[model samples]
Target: MSMSLRRRSGHGARLGAAGLLTFAALAGTGAAHADVAAPRALPAGCSGTSPITCHYAVAPGNYDVTVSLGGAASAGQTEMWVEARRLMLPATRTAAGSVATYSFTVNVRQPEGQPTGQGGTGNPGLNIRFTGSNPQVSAVSVKPAPQPLVAYLAGDSTVCDQPSAPYTGWGQVITTAVRPGAVIANYADSGESSGSFLSNAALFPALLSKIRANDPVFIQLGHNDKQTSASAYRNNLDTMISRVRAKGGVPVLVTPPVRRLFDGNRLTPTALHVNGVGVNLPAEMRAVGTAQRVPVIDLTAKSKALVESLGTSASAQLFLRSSVDGVTDNTHFSQYGATRIGELLLQGIREQRLSLAAYLR
Candidate 1:
């Protein structure tokens, strides 16, 4: 009935009671209860319009999710008055020829005292069933409450919007590991920054226009912040952060990616970075953030460590393919490698020890 169901309000979760939320870590296993996405929004079939809340989500698999109405002697049968139609989804998210199954649930309720809505009468409920290959297996379930949000990411080129193609920055890594659903949105561009992201006459303002309360902003710059220590690009960190905070948005800063180069003795993060690849920027950005008392995501340091761990031979697979002209492929990541970084980002979230694991689905 309400966004916060009083009964499902507690943080505690039931393993098989049709409502346990699971946030997928690197494993990308079955999604958690809270982190799972709702099937879709449709007209309510339940009679009356008293604002009922639906608890439903599908985990990763090929599923045959179905909904039907029924009731027990203790109560009435679930009526379809309020529900326009029961949803039935076919297999998705798994291998095509492989047999698999998926499941989801819908919970209906009234706040007691309000006029009953469709399916709100008695203890009437919908019975969701599944039948496919391997009908019986180990699975988890739980109902989850909405999460409180407190951060946002805003940047350009390397740390902004997640480009669908032409492999680019690692910003998506942060979001993939930290939360799911509406928890994060990337507003970065391939060649934007504090100034260009804001002014560019056609950029900045439009991006910041949609941010809301407690939604912290994360900034990553260096390649474009310029090498100078006091350029408007570099100097604006605090001012930009303050302006964001004044608007009730928290602010975070991230270092740029390390240049894909090898020192005579070891990996040199600060080397030739063409193709607008902003290597070493994140590392430098992290420094200013430390002094400013702002949170910092050391992607540069972390990425450097990742490259070092994989070694240049194995790590090169993560970067864009090198064509003649070097293809300007200095900082961007490959898809397979991007997933790996996403896994690491989740580890970072855990290391930071924030209350964000609940959003992992």
Candidate 2:
């Protein structure tokens, strides 16, 4: 769906002194009963609407985080994203003088801190970001997690953690669906075909080296695999599944989401993810899943149903349209669309009876 976009820089708007006072007062008042106590004076950097980032210089690893949401004088709504824009919380609305506490696990690494993706480097530590109509933060806590169910994602741009706004990937938003004790490490990068993922040192090799027993490795490619032969595509997927199995990890196949291409009321074969050589990539992935006895999340089918149901014009909200971002990207998703896809992924996990489903929020 994309090549790597620019990484988010540390520079962003900051809250004014009065705004800080408002946050401090609201945060202090809510500290008594909250699980993660709010600081009497919230450190600077919390912004109003633009993303406010707070970085903790910690080593690369999984950390359990608890955040107290809401501190604005009036009602506020907020969303949280960790390193590389991994959505840990969706838009949460809070009334005036109210605080909502949420906890989740985040995997932080060096360079970009993201599980995978080559892009602008990340600062050394954990970066917690807040963004929404009226973003707010009362308190924040980070503790190294002893162990957490790590869900590893591997795929193309459609499934990677998109670095910027408007153009979102399902992997970036799926973290919001799970609670603590589970962390999603997205290694999926833009422009990666199945073969490239398997061969890329920064991708599959790094992912394989980190796999623990019972870990779920979700693989979804095909957006860039359009030129790959059917046999090679299937073989690459099989090899990836086998490698995960060899590492005592479980492999789950996810079909690539459909493009926003439509012909009249129905979608065209190309939009449905048929390859340049006339192969249905999703169907091939399904065949591999069946042959390997791996669970397959049919995102292609699910997304197709969703897009066709909405039809051409209405479905623009499900993608990055020029109206919103000054650019129409039929392949990439907006935040709302990514959130929906994340929900669909959660549903697929439940349907497959994945152990990770137990930790979903």
Candidate 3:
């Protein structure tokens, strides 16, 4: 069985594979070959019949994707490319690859939607490690990673899906209260992870290209980074920071937001368990900041402090006021939440004394 879903754009209708797709599942299944719309979809410029197939689109931002392979898509190796959403990937797929699982990442690009940047890991919508026995797109567990200020939240649905939902992450809100020129490019996808986000082919590259000499790229990971350790969030963070610094962008680290966990009526940050450790990351963050010589925001600490002040009951007030989507979401933010976190980031910038502080009001 196969499944395919196209997230329709607000202004566009359902787009067919502008070319042809040889409907094959990602499992490298040796089953009969036939184009199945469920698992395979193609975009412009792809031959649609070759071993290296591409699904390109001109849209920007993040996306969640599932890729499967049928007989032909499986027997022969395959190379994939998601055109508009940036990052880096092999120009083609090989027969040695597994096809059972779906690939998810936050695709990024230039304002006009073109690929730009050093295609590395943590890009959305452009990767999957197909070990022969690995089941398709299965995430046994997920946790947050060491996050920093100036979050570049990039993933599928887990990203800024709504102005109100921070269960995904709160980069948007974290960016707002800062001075007007500060950059908070929330490119995270709701369903993306370190493995896939790095391979998206467009977005990551664009992010790299977009880096200015003084830009600080804060990463709020773990929500998805923990889902796939093969891509190792810590290592990725280390590498991403190096890249950002190499490109002249300051790299701040952040820990994932704590879950809405309460302990016998007390709001506890310890509930977001990671190897018996929680995600409230001030210690780890402070070290990373000192080691990397970049400022750390410690939003997790501040948020935890705020929760402590609000108490377990009032803690709910930090989230967005829901409409039909339910109210008081914790994982994400509302305008109010985003605003608060954004202010925290601005404060972090000031404390760090980055020359860029002049940009923050």
Candidate 4:
């Protein structure tokens, strides 16, 4: 199902796919197609769709999106995602006969969203998708944002927006923990290391082109850097920092989060991200942060404390277990685990007093 819209002034005035997406343009693009709505009951552009997708064709840049949720006929719950699967809003419930309005910034680019480094990823234009038990999108307003801060994420699968549900990354949900005015554009991909991410033309090079003045580029790796030497890892990080600085972007280092590996109540060294070559990866990240004068979010230490405090049985909820996600994965995070890690990242932002901290929700 699809519809078209007429471009407006300002943003829409710019060249190529730039415009506001009203209710008329919202459609269902998911597996379950939408039920065509009655004129009076649903908004003109919206369909009574479980997974309603609204796409705004616009020039690559940041956009301010406002969504009015809930229905007059029945109570509803909704989860909003943009670009790829970056969770913009967590599941929210609204009562019947009421509308809850929400606004957030989104960074739109050509590849559309983060490519997982694996094939078959990304969508075209500024895509806003809604899904949940009952998703009621009454109205939507998309406008070009003027110079909002953009937080770019770079790392591996644990930090990338997993193309599928149930398996998520912290970067995908971090936007939910932040206030408006700041948008997160995750470039992290699966099986990426510091070395590979920097050298990849489609990843780091693309990120550098988008860096605005004072933009914060958060780098987290080590999950796939198992064989990288300490000196090489540091060098990769230093090069990234230097390039970001040249572009007037502030580079922040982030150690990888710990795996849910436990040994009798304490996390094993491997769980703590000690590489195959006997390098303490997180410690090395901290050292680089110090030498480069960059703020480092010690996610390894923070996640270690949380995992250890929760212990074996409880901490299992922090990762994808076989029963939950149909796969026993110790490294990747489940939705709950991803949210928890996102919270830890928020805490780190506040602790380090990074400029992005000022926008934390």
Can you write out model 1's per-residue Cα lDDT over 1-361, one digit (the tens) per residue? 0011011222322333322222221111222222122222222332222222232333311122223211111111121111112212211122212212223322222210011121222223332322222121122233331333534445544443332444644444433222222344444555655565555533335335545675656676555655434435446676677777677666777666565687643576354222233433454456567777777766666767877877766777767666522554756666445545544544455455434434443
Q: Return the TM-score for each candidate structure.
A: 0.54, 0.85, 0.50, 0.86
- Predicted structure with the largest TM-score when compared to the true one: 4
* Per-residue accuracy of model 2 over 42-77 as CA lDDT, tens digit each: 544344445667888889889988887664556667
C-alpha lDDT of all candidate models, in order: 0.41, 0.76, 0.42, 0.77
* Deviating ranges (above 4 Å) for candidate 3: 1-169, 173-184, 227-231, 268-287, 320-328
lDDT of 2 at 111: 56
Q: How big is the positional error of residue 90 in model 3, measured in Å on the Cα after superposition?
A: 44
Quote the positional error of residue 307 for candidate 4 in Å.
0.6
Candidates 1 and 4, the one with greater TM-score: 4
Off by over 4 Å in 2: 1-40, 43-51, 71-74, 113-118
Instruction: Give candidates' CA RMSD values in order.
Output: 14.2, 8.9, 17.4, 9.2
State candidate 1's TM-score.
0.54
* Position 81, candidate 1: lDDT: 13
> Mind giving the per-residue lDDT tens digits that candidate 4 earns over 1-361?
0011111211111112322121212222111222333222444444548788777777878888877776446667788888768777667666666666667788787665455336354655788888988888877988898889999999888888787877888888777655458888888888888898998888999889989899999999899988999999999999999999999999999999999887899999999989999999899999999988999999999999999999999898879888878998889999879878877787788778999976654
Candidate with better TM-score, 3 vs 4: 4
